[model samples]
Target: MDGKKALYYAAIAIAVLIGVGIVISVISALVTLVSTVISAAISLAVLAGIVYVAYKAGSWLLGSDDSPSMDSIGSGSSTSVDAGTSRQDRLRQQYVEGQISEAEFERRIGEELETEEIDDIDRELERER
Candidate 1:
């Protein structure tokens, strides 16, 4: 839950506990001792549980996660790769758009012309280990 809601609930719980204590103390003066003690004990336990849960929810709201995930640490994009373009087509467009000189385009295109099949680099490292 959010900070405001958590605090509100905590305040409500405190109010309820205080109300119960007052009622019990008033009744104890007029009634038997045993019932008053039992009601006070139950109220205390309930109040403690509420406080613990509220504290935990507040911590979560405050973003106190000790470990971070990859998605939270890195950025990525949503654009999908186009299926219609050949590698040559993309190179042609890059040149037409004036993003790269013809010489640089040709050089990069040539470099990418002979790519080998990719294997699992992680698995290879593990094998060596």
Candidate 2:
């Protein structure tokens, strides 16, 4: 009867030890998962920051200067040939001065022509109305 009692106590102790080990293992796994998630988040944030900085730097480096606004294209101040000079002339000057690429100059000229046309059409519509 005493031996039976000893065996029953040993069984309970083993069961308790196993339960504690399982709990510790589960806790460890959860901690590892959390750490991994945090690491990945930090890495992604750093990458995003780098990309943003690069984008800003590229824009600053490649941005044009003092170019005429689209809104000024069809205005009286923009279309004058002598004092203000036409937008096309300004774009050509910029191209000649190496401030803008030939392609950019051509594109801006096309835009100016389109804006002028649109403005004329709008004026005609207003007159009709």
Candidate 3:
């Protein structure tokens, strides 16, 4: 029992030491980063602006405007994966493109009709189209 308790205490002490080490390392890195940014010719704030522009441009080129960003966090957004396209439309497309057999398309459409989530407006639009 004493041996087990000693092992447990030693393990806890090691964990605490590791946590302290991590905290110290993070503080040292932050201090270094701030100092380097302050000592540079251009301001750190300007560097942050360049980084933000590069990030937005990269996202635009990749055609993913909905990537996680502070701008979108509080905004109302689309609830579905494909906002304008329905599952039935996609399944029909697959069949027409020869990606799926007609039987597979039928199976998928049935499954989508039974198991898919569609808002009333989307369902009405799909029917109209």
Candidate 4:
């Protein structure tokens, strides 16, 4: 009877493993399908942009100014186009200019990260309050 009970448990375990495998296979197939669809959509969008740009160039050559402006092609924000220095960019610039030692630059960046984290936490606390 004990041997029979052991076989029963082993069979149950095998069945459960098979069921899990089937579920994983189905989920993987679904994810692959979704990824393919997204890729196709992005490809179509890029192709459309290229065609539109070509049409605009043709129109411009024929003496028309109906093409979208450069701002429309990229981020239209003036602030983003300005000489803004990110933390990493500033660190690199300082190191390159001999204004800071490598170790000091790293330390400053680490401190900046900590400060940003603290600021984020404070902001969240304020929001909650």
Error of model 3, residue 22, in angstroms: 0.5
Candidate 4 yields a Cα-based lDDT of 0.79
Error of 3 at 28 (Å): 0.5
lDDT (Cα) of model 3: 0.76
Q: For residues 63-84, could you state the per-residue lDDT of candidate 2 as single tens digits?
A: 7434554666777634443332
Lowest lDDT block of 10, candidate 1 = 75-84
Error of 4 at 12 (Å): 0.5
Q: TM-score of model 1 relative to the true fold?
A: 0.29
Which ranges of candidate 1 are over 4 A from the true structure? 1-31, 65-129
lDDT per residue for candidate 4 within 1-129, as digits (tens), equals 999999999999999999999999999999999999999999999999999999888888886775455654674333322322366688889999999998998898788777666766776797799
Q: Better model by TM-score, 1 or 2?
A: 2
Greater lDDT among 3 and 4 belongs to 4
The TM-score values for the models, in the order shown, are: 0.29, 0.49, 0.32, 0.49
For this target, which candidate reaches the highest lDDT against the unseen true structure? 2
Q: Would you list the C-alpha lDDT of every candidate in the order shown?
A: 0.68, 0.80, 0.76, 0.79
> Going through the candidates in order, what is the number of backbone clashes in each?
0, 0, 0, 0
Q: Regarding TM-score, does 3 or 4 come out ahead?
A: 4
**Residue-level error in angstroms, candidate 3, position 91:** 75
For candidate 1, the per-residue lDDT at 43 reads: 100
Which digits, one per residue and each the tens of the lDDT, describe model 1 over residues 1-129? 699999999999999999999999888776766778889999999999999889877877797744443444542221111211255578888899999999988897775553311223444575799
